[model samples]
Target: MSYVLNDPAAFADESTDGFVAAHRSLVRRVPGGVARTTAVPEGHVAVVIGGGSGHYPAFGGLVGAGLADAAVLGNVFASPSAQQIYTVAKAVATEAGVLLSYGNYAGDVLNFDQAEQRLIAEGIPTRTVRVTDDIYSASSDERQKRRGIAGDLAVFRAAAWAAEQGLDLDAVAAVAARANERTRSMGVAFSGCTLPGATEPLFTVPEGQMAVGMGIHGEPGIGVQPLPTAKQLGELFVEALLAELPDGVTSVDGARLAVILNGLGSVKAEELFVIYATVSTELERAGATIVDPEVGEYATSFEMAGVSLTLLWLDDELESAWTAPAYAPAYRKGAVATGDTELLTDDDAAAETETIAAAATPEAAEAGRTARDVIVAIRDMIDREADELGRLDSIAGDGDHGIGMKRGTVAAARAAEAAADAGAGAGTVLALAGDAWADKAGGTSGALWGLALRAAGDVIGDTEAPSAHTVAEAVEAARAGIQNFGKAVVGDKTLVDSLVPFSDGLTARANEGAALAVAWAGAADDATRAAAATADLLPRMGRARPHMEKSLGTPDPGAISLALAMHAAASVLNHTTAQKEES
Candidate 1:
């Protein structure tokens, strides 16, 4: 069901080949999985970087004309060997000497130290800069043992720029060491990632939950806990990071800091920005000035769904370099213009455009009069089956699907009634229903339903009257939008299992000249059947996939609910059409 590259062993080789090929002009591959800068200055200080492979742009991609002189790459979730370290050091060393900089993982420390001795024996000067910026990694007594996270970017970038500017080996190493001392990062994962070729995920978290302080290599986190809202999570990260800062430390010239919000893959940009908004507010309250901030997937683990926040206590020198001109496929430093202007006139402006209005035309009013009874009937059926749905989800999912569906539908029905009373258009009524579902439902399902409703409403915007065909087209468009945005397919064991079939059946019936109500009712039946049939299929995505075997034989709650809603819609359509014909 999930379409992923089959050969896991080939991941490292394939990825490295593509990476080097793309940046061949700026970087060169050294022996032992190490890459070096192609345009190293003759006597400039050398900067060496290294890390595990999956967190690209950290260790390898940063090697270039203005960045690291060399980078040693490791296998996925594994450390590079000592030989790999030595190979890179030898390739990039100069009389001015090489400064070895990398994360604080145990394997990295051992191998890098081994390579440091080897380079020294060869009469090539080398110094080590260990980065240990993860606040969750250890207590104050054992801070040196903490693993590095996004803070490595700031350390490496600052050190490399110093080296590029002709700082001596000791000076460059000192700058990097200072950056590590002042920086700290913390993260939480919504889900874990699968290693190449591994059918099972590396770790697991309970559904509808998250693991705080999870390591990059799928290491067990502090514990599984309720997933926080973006704002709440941001606050947690900021509080922890600030607690770790020294009492009197200020940015260079006594300013505050610059923040880096690094996505751990699969976390969307919108979510990251939401987190950033919360973080900025917290920083302001702490009397810290954030000179600049970065938000994006700068470091990742294949497709892990999480994010890490890195805070750097900046000096004027570091600030300049942090803002210096640099570019790579995955990392860049650029200015973003901001002004003291309000983008929205009011809080409602922040709501989706389709959410604010709810009015139906005369034709839609008639349609809703018929549809209202059907919706009530379906809602009653869902209320009756709530226990069964919960038990099924408990086998593999968070077991909240039933409750979420019940709440969403109840809210939607109330909104629909409100729309009808307001004499709103059909689309406006649907939009209101969607807003209700979104507001009531939590987690991914709520977001998906909200998006689907918003898309459908946009398509039917301001229509004075709508026929069955128009309603069908709008629903089809909404379904397409859900498919586009959610990237879900029929066998993903999502609502699509029911929705796809329901939409197809409805369209087929409509094409064959069936009345809208009759066609919709038939489609609803097909959806329910399809969803029941899929009980034998394993879920292939989201939190349910980790418990795939358990999920088997349990129909997806979202799918079942979707089918129920479609059937209800069909019944209402048929009643309205019949009434029209009689009149």
Candidate 2:
């Protein structure tokens, strides 16, 4: 039940703009997300954190002196693109190596891992520590598979504190890793969450019943039962969290703990306080001493009627780190020493770009013009089908794919136009567009699109127009790049399904001496068939994995989107050749 929104598609971007506008003192706008307005000190590890946009303060709200240096935001319930992650890391990195941290989710793992590699390749050292503390997501034997929940605060705070204390990158990562092992969280939902334009929530709970062991991404809980009283709910949380004591503690006696009772969106503060009161009493009964107990929102789903409890078992070092001062937009502790608060903006770059000019050969310049038209067609198609794409995603995954694709394609279209106008080559235009797509659409789809576009561009050298063989090779490379980078196989019910078929069809047709335009059209037909066939396959990766049954009758949004884009691109290629004939 989101009450305020202009266009549902623009909700995430508009909200991010508003967040920075209201908190200029603490965080300033950056390409990926927000950075602390105060200068990032050199000779210290930079802690960068991120995830989907709906979690708010969990990511961006935690950017400050004693927390994250920057937060990379993505679309609602999606992970930030690899380019966004890399750009933010580059912006904030100092002499010391950078540390990238986020919750354990498929998209986050894919994007962050790629960013880490890119940073390392650029000779800027980087490390990563994924937060995994949700006790319900997996068994103790499969701890690495667990998802992170409100417990992310404990890990991020500890790691950021270590960085502030001048710890090296490995030491900082170790601190976060230890914190993750000692922390455990569990949540229950009284009702499901509805996206901005949706008429109903992602899932529903019957009146007087509640869902237990739920995830934050509009996913239903593992079990359902009648609602309990506040004290009973407290007992449930404690019992669930304590059942798996994280391998270190055999008993709760004399153990120091940091307890957090989090409200997931629609839950009220007063109600939370009532629950925490009983929660504290229960902890005392278990002989666990509560230290710095926090009771408020930290991580959240969009207006989900839910609550989560987190416990961080603390040793002496963890205690000191936990008590260290912090001042972020959402969370705060003791006062922080103020430093330079200067901000960077586009105005700072305008002067630097004044002398730049695009470089291209005559044939390549014509190819660049055609690339511009193709990008425009892609953007228009996305805008036209944005709502439908989102609806399809909502059937199993979070309903943000359409808007994310629309944002990426629109940004790509604009960048391609600018590059063509400046006399850039086809490869340069595609490269610029790819960067924009990743920057604007921070998600798994965005990252994959970036990989596809960049790989294709690499084959289309700037000196000449690409031949039919070159075009076929570009398609094969794009498909291979996506498959390798995303680690999704053909039967995973992802875009890889259509992408592989399209690439094969193009290469086969091209080898038989067909024209580039005709080969691409035939390939597009192959993609359409493959995408439609995905309706029968169960999802093996990404957010849709949890709701496999819901997706059985519907085509994967990613696969369908890729097919549609290829169809549009085929039209563009044919139109270009037809115009050349007429002229």
Candidate 3:
């Protein structure tokens, strides 16, 4: 559906580069994303906002004087890596601190929390406030479980305003949290979005029907209804938001609200204004005062025919913060004063070249080469199966799983091959591969895989070749890392569904004194069976939870991909065994 792209995998990066080029005066290139070109005062808290790339003006386009000081850009519909977030935060951080803000999504939460910990460990004060404003995502009582939508604008603006006022990190974080709590949003989609190079959209609504409560990441809506006129849609938006006011607000009457009528891509400004026309009238009829109503694209899905409405119940402080001046590529509010600017000298620090160490012995070097071969097999397998995996994911998620897996495995394979050529040990090879996978993939699966690989590598050290027992132990370590990091159990219908069985099978075979190849083959079989079993279960975690019923007949994409990787690794080990037997 994305017609004007060379390689789908490179679209996010290429688009970011072009964006930076176009907004050179307002923003400059940073490691993970973009930062303001203007100067900031010393001891002022820096407000850093980020999410996936599909939402224009939300992340990159909001980097300027009164919005975000920096924005971390992730792959399309994928959260950025923790390393990327840390790099971007460090690039914009001042003596006071840094406040990392983003939408409330699983991947974003995991990576941002990791980055927050790393920043604090290095003595940089860092805080995070996740925006949860989509009223339809969850029941009002379960507000914390709600997803963030177009309400990101209000939260980001409030936080940035507090920062611009020279507030410390804690104060800025409080403002962002307050903004999130006060904001409520709901959306509807007439159609779904397609990923680049994909022949079909992720999901589609029937003609003359619309999906209500759809997500920005190509997730299908919770419910469907016949499409209505612009006026009827506006009434729907106003009625839904007013049904439940934030805790502080007692009544909708006399309530001052900051309204955002956001077009979720393909719904142009004129169409939005037509909807806003009715939305404003409805709000006024409800006896609520609208303040600075925004009618345009703020947070968007790639070419999704949808619109979301956000209402921020403003108190005195929130109103003042909301009215503050801002200047950005996609958003400009009032007059913003300028100052002398200087380019970041440490921008190139993120580009430091990696050097692989020589193995301690020839056996370790040979093991590293074997690891590289295994990674290459995994990469090839993913390339072959990506489309099917993505199809499964599209049933309940953003449908980027296959592409994400391919990106990770390809990057991992390259890193593994380079490490093996440098005579690195198996441990170093796997660890470097994991880092590359995470850095390039940038999603929930990417983070988990990278962590699992690194954990396994840590157990297998760089000193010597691994025995069957050592390999089993390493696999167990990997399984443990995934469970601990992702917090998913077997029935959760995640990759852990397959990984746990595979790990247990490997440990059992190794304990029975089986050879590495035989043990791995048996474990791979277990993983394949476990992956297939997931088709009978409903997803209880991650992005698929909201659409659990839709995924009932399909296996989790993560589980399938893990099983495929396990089988690929087994094939490599079997080939090595065969070669040894021949010799």
Candidate 4:
């Protein structure tokens, strides 16, 4: 468990603040995360790597000379929002373009791809290479679906080195992809990790047993077995990696490899050295030469009692990039030549904030106030149900959905209130609330909800008060946007499970000439029932897919949260109807 914190919810933010302060000479605070304090050569391809926080050196710590130009940090165990990634990229990107790299998780892929599209649309040449190197997550035929673990380090380093060598955007991206293909990793957990403010670990390993093939996001392993000795563990890692070489590697007998024995948080340096000794011995015995081997905490999962081993089978070009001199806060190799650093101005560090436009009509202003009230109610409802949602998520997924929802709704409520107070229209209020939710929460749920709200806002413009038919149209638009963005269908056991039924129900009721409040109530009930029904479905996507059996009897946290939000919105509608009747 993480022992120290100001507020559990604010732990990630606060820790980032401290890290920037401590490494001011190396990095500067950017809106989304951190950027290199020292300037890179102008028009050089900037390598931007990131993922969820809690995996320290992987992201922020890697921002410096010969490494990542910027890192877009998210809340613990959650991928950063698309807005966050865009902001970070814009800060560091030059005329040469940018290379974005991160682990191959569902949320990271979604957010990063969105950011990549936005950058290209804005005339910034941006490319991406998602690291997929965890051998245990998927078979060789399905390697693209594998989760990224410590192999993130190898890919990030290679891409950054390519950029440092004055390579163009395409070359940097290609190098990153090559590094990812050559890298292979496997991890084991003695016990699961616990998030801040959580009462217990996300999942627990039985005493004297080790969970094999666990993910850094607190996902349980594919199987469990008795804990092995350090030597035996080293043998297991070497054997697995040697058995399946990368496509070009004909044999491991004389292969040159870049090795990383990474400690996942609580594991000590001494223990790692002991394992590395055995690892080195085994590799040499197998006639493979290890070069520039790193043994320490490079990437971590808060305080997980686990470790991972990564082997990057190196070609001539790869060897040059892998062995280059580098300097980052947490990772350092040979001495890096120093030069005068550039200090960013206030405007460079500050992200652009949205401006509130005036309402088009007084009726629209009143509707904005109603929207604010609805968001506030939803926030309150989420606050009450957060723990239960977390419990359900922890059964098979990383237990952060509850906290992510809370953060998003709180930010949304505040933004909506501010917009309404500024005399903005309902459309503007919803759009602003969506931005706040996505920016503050930074995860899959946050991005989807933000997209849904913004899509609805686009349909319900500021020109007039929305009629029941217009409201139904807005709901349909929101549903369409979520399905398009997340690519999750009704039976995927995602929030779409509930959202689809709710949208269809509302559209049906409104088409029948029902009142807005009456239609919303029916839709809310449909959503609730649909969410409950998800307990019987197996997960087909995201982190939960690997442990689908464990989640058999539990409803998806995303589906349940969407249902709760709908019910809360329905309550607001009911109250407004009651007030109108009394008047």
Candidate 5:
């Protein structure tokens, strides 16, 4: 169950090689094996950035037409050497001079300082900007010591634009400094990340708890706190940033900001958006005008389950630069129409009615009802066993799978009930369930559940009265679709270990002319058996495998939950059919 590369040294080299190979056209290797890009427009202030390898798009992904001119990549969580930085600076600097912008960590500062000295000796003008924007990192004395998080993007963009405008070295440095001053970022981690091929995580957090102000490279956080809802988390982050704002600004009246909601690694866009919506609304209420809002995986730490919020106070110049069109591999902007009153007021009721009507089929409706009931039962079972499942996953995983599964299942059930009460049919119910999972669940399980429900709805199609065979076919199609998307094989000790067997058993029985009741029951039984058998095997996928022996004898909670769901479906189908016959 260990990772494919256990050692950080090797993993870092392999990853950097792959990155350079993939972007060969846009990047070139300099004297110190540092990669440099010339995509930035000439005479634009050349911004050279660098950091460890694992934080994709941070040091490299932003290198392109509108962003960084060059980036020096280092080993995992380690800063590149001075020679590397100097080489990249030499390669990318234009007549306006180069701006060296990076996080304020000791390693980065030490290395970049050396590079600056070297660049000066070689007659190349250079300026340095160190990002120290994490409010939780330290108090006044320690403020300079805090590590940078996701605010590097804002600093880089502002400094680069200033440089592009042919600002002097001091002015460029001031722009970067001001951007850093206005920027404050904070992050929370639900789970730790594994170095490539590592058997264990670099750090660990307790289940149902989050580590606030956790560093990107597994540094200890300011404190551990109970996991908050996305809305609550957003409020807390916004409050923290607002509290730390310079006295004159953010006093409930004078704050104008650009907000960046960034995913650490594994957090999905849907979940990130929820946080963004909450933060944006809260800021608006606080009298802050959001000049720019960037949401995505702009910075990451190899599948870490966490997110960060970075706020930058906006001046007129900074505002213009922030909104200025810039193209990068990961960030971009296009012309957007302003204040389209007609489009905003267009009739949406008719479209909404058509959409709902299209999804209201009898067979789909019945399937949705069954799914709702099954999800409720599954949620109950998970709640009862949540602690035990957490203990099991804790040994080889982050231990949140149990809690995540319970939350996702319960959310799905509630959504289904709400949709049904609203007189929505199966497709609408399933869509609601998917959205709930996407909202409440923050990791791999949530994504899978969301995908599964959506695929099931798609398979049911437009039919109002699908036969039993159609139902079975839809189930099979869902199983296949999940398998295709996830790429988990039967023996991987993944949910597929149970689901594949169940799908096959059901298909066999259905094809043999067995009653739907008998077929579903058999399928549920087989799934349960297969899930139990997974205890004897080791997991080879997801975050669990890193714990090695931890999961050897414990069934994957996902697999067990899937079996429970099938059994619940069997009960619902049998009861419904008997009542129909009697009537």
Candidate 6:
């Protein structure tokens, strides 16, 4: 349980405020997350790393002299928006380029890759290295599918060190990839963690039982068994790593390893030492030389009462990089050379907020008003149903979907209103709203929604009002964008599940010469039915994949939320149609 003050939704932001206040000498506030207060030298490849907010010392805390130059943070247990990542990277970018790194979660992969492309388009070279090191998340052959846990440190540190040494983006990224490949982690949870203001934990293990192979996002473990003693637990950790040595390493005999016994959250230092004592002996018995064994909270789940162990097999280059001194807020090592410029004060580091609008026609501007109305309706409905949506998401995923939807929709509504007030067209308003939704919500759903909204907006050009045929085409475009960005086909149990049917229904109705409102209402009905049908689907992607069985009877929160938003939009269109007929 988190014993923090302030609203739960604002917890991350407020905590970040305090962190910047306390570490003004080392870190400064950036638009997305934190950046090193020290000036980055020209041509230095900026190493930007990030993920969700709950994993401290991991993201924000690791931004300093020897680690990430900047970190982008999202909502608890979610990935940061692409806009956020882009902003951070650009702010800290150098002539050499940028290297983005983070855990291998789907949301992170989607958002970070999107940012990398955006940065490259701006002529800033960018590369990415995803840490896929959790041995328990996937089979040995599917190493890329593994979730990154405590092993995030190994990748981040080596990459940042390489960047600090003035390596180019490609070389820095390769170093991080090698570290990620050599890393492996596994953990057990005796209990689960509760998000701020939540009464129940995200998961629960039966008393006297331990859940094995659990995720940092409060996901229940893949296996359960009676709790074992410290020595036994240590043995389990050692065996899991030894069983899956990286390619070219046939045996652990005489291999040098960088070991980390990381507390997920609440596990004490003493207990970790006790476990590490056994872990150390076990490693030596296997003829492995442990180099710089670290025992602390590196990447943590908020208040999760468990720990994970990471093993990074080190070659000569890796050994040098691993031993390099770092000066981050949390994971400091030997002293670093001090040539940083004057530290950025917290007040001086405030990011500028600005909005730019495109030209619009009077008719298109009128359409923008209706678009704003649709977003307001979405906000209202999501606010009303947030708890229910969150409850449903809790079945197999982090129970943040409802609140995430509320945040995104509210932000979207505000952005839409701003665009309309600035005399922007419908397409521009929708595009602004989509950007806001993704930036504020910061998750897989947010990213998909952003892509869908932007796709639709592009089809609905700002120069003119959209007709029924145009609207249908826009929906189809949105569907295509969702499919392309998410790589989720119909059976993936994602927003695609409902988006495809809605697009089909709209096209069918529009082709019959139906009005935009009429066609949209029918399409909304189809989407509603499709979303309901997903209750029987087993998720093949996102955080829900590991808990597929638990989600057997529940609709995907992403699909359900999209359907709800589309239904809300249809109602606005229907109301506008009725008003015209009355006039």
Q: Which stretches of candidate 6 lie over 4 Å from their true place?
A: 340-359
Error of 4 at 537 (Å): 0.9
lDDT of each: 0.71, 0.86, 0.90, 0.90, 0.71, 0.87
For residues 1-583, what per-residue lDDT tens digits would candidate 4 score against the true structure?
Answer: 8889879989989999999889878888888899988666797998888889998887899888778999999998999999999999999889999899999888888789889999999999999999999999988999998989999999998998899889888988898899999999999999999998887999999999999999999999988999999999999988988888998889878999999999999999999999999999999998899999999998899899998999999998899989998899998889898866576732576778778997899999988888889899999999999999988998888888898899999999999999999998889989889888987887788888888888898888887888889989998999998888789998889999999999999999999999999999999999999999999999988888878888998999999999999999999989988998999
Off by over 4 Å in 5: 1-8, 31-44, 247-250, 335-583
Q: List where candidate 4 sits over 4 angstroms from the true fold.
A: 345-347
Worst 10 residues of 4 by lDDT: 340-349
lDDT of 1 by residue, 410-448 (tens): 767787777666666656666667766654443345546
- 1 against 5, candidate with superior lDDT: 5
Per-residue lDDT tens digits for candidate 5, residues 454-563, read 67666655446445566577677768866776667898887788888888898888888888888889999999999999898887665454343557888887787678
Candidate 2 lDDT tens digits, 16-94: 8999888887887777677777656778899999998888677899998778988988877778888778878887887
Model 2 TM-score is 0.91
For each candidate, give its TM-score against the true structure: 0.56, 0.91, 0.98, 0.98, 0.56, 0.97
Q: Worst ten-residue run, lDDT, model 2? A: 347-356
Candidates 5 and 6 compared: the better one by lDDT is 6
RMSD (CA, Å), candidate 5 to true, equals 20.6
> In candidate 5, how many Å is residue 490 off?
57
The regions of model 1 sitting more than 4 angstroms off are 1-6, 34-37, 247-254, 334-583
> Residue 35's C-alpha lDDT in candidate 5?
37
Quickly count the clashes in candidate 2.
Answer: 0
Candidate 3 RMSD computed on C-alpha atoms after optimal superposition onto the true structure: 1.3
What is the Å distance of residue 517 in model 5 from its true position?
A: 84
Clashing pairs in 1: 251-255, 252-314, 252-315, 359-424, 359-425, 360-423, 360-424, 360-425, 517-573, 517-574
